[model samples]
Target: MFYRIITLKTTKEIWQTKRSESNRILGIVNNVRLFGTNFSNSRIFQKLLVIITERFETTISSLENINDLSTIILAELLNAL
Candidate 1:
């Protein structure tokens, strides 16, 4: 049915949006990991954190939507820093 098709399309769009957001968050986390200790002092890293918080309305704790691997990596990086 047309309604079912529309619902499926909407679901796909939502999934894509979540995927994009997760990728963006993962990239930021990787960058932080690469910076290591320097990340805590870097102005750019601070800005990225602000952006993540403000734009995504997400904190490190709220990244449960991301995959397990990325979540683990982020957790390790957080611990390291």
Candidate 2:
């Protein structure tokens, strides 16, 4: 999510707007910091690596079946043409 408020340079208005903008930027920085910390602690990358490895092994084991299916489809397409 993104938000922006454009304000012309005025005496008091500029000061107030600047303060709000500074606060908003600080809030975003803090949120990103927290998210990075949590992501590291969760070890999500390791879990994803395990899942991808298992899926890849499964695919490799089934390559013969996949090849046969692709060959059948290609022959059918050529016949249609």
Q: Pick the candidate with the highest lDDT.
A: 1
Task: Compute the lDDT of residue 65 as modeled in candidate 2.
Answer: 41
User: In the order shown, what is each candidate's alpha-carbon RMSD?
Assistant: 9.5, 21.3
Assess every candidate by TM-score: 0.41, 0.32
Worst 10 residues of 2 by lDDT: 72-81
lDDT of 2 by residue, 1-81 (tens): 011223454557655655664465446445646776654412332232243334245443444344443233322311221
Q: Quote the positional error of residue 59 for candidate 1 in Å.
A: 8.7
Superposed by TM-score, candidate 1 places the C-alpha of residue 67 at a distance from the truth, in angstroms, of 21
Clashing pairs in 1: none
Model 1 per-residue lDDT tens digits across residues 2-76:
232355557777566556655775687567678674543334434554665444344433543343332244434
**How many residue pairs clash (N, CA or C atoms closer than 3 angstroms) in each of the candidate models, in the order given?**
0, 0
Q: List the global CA lDDT of all models.
A: 0.48, 0.39
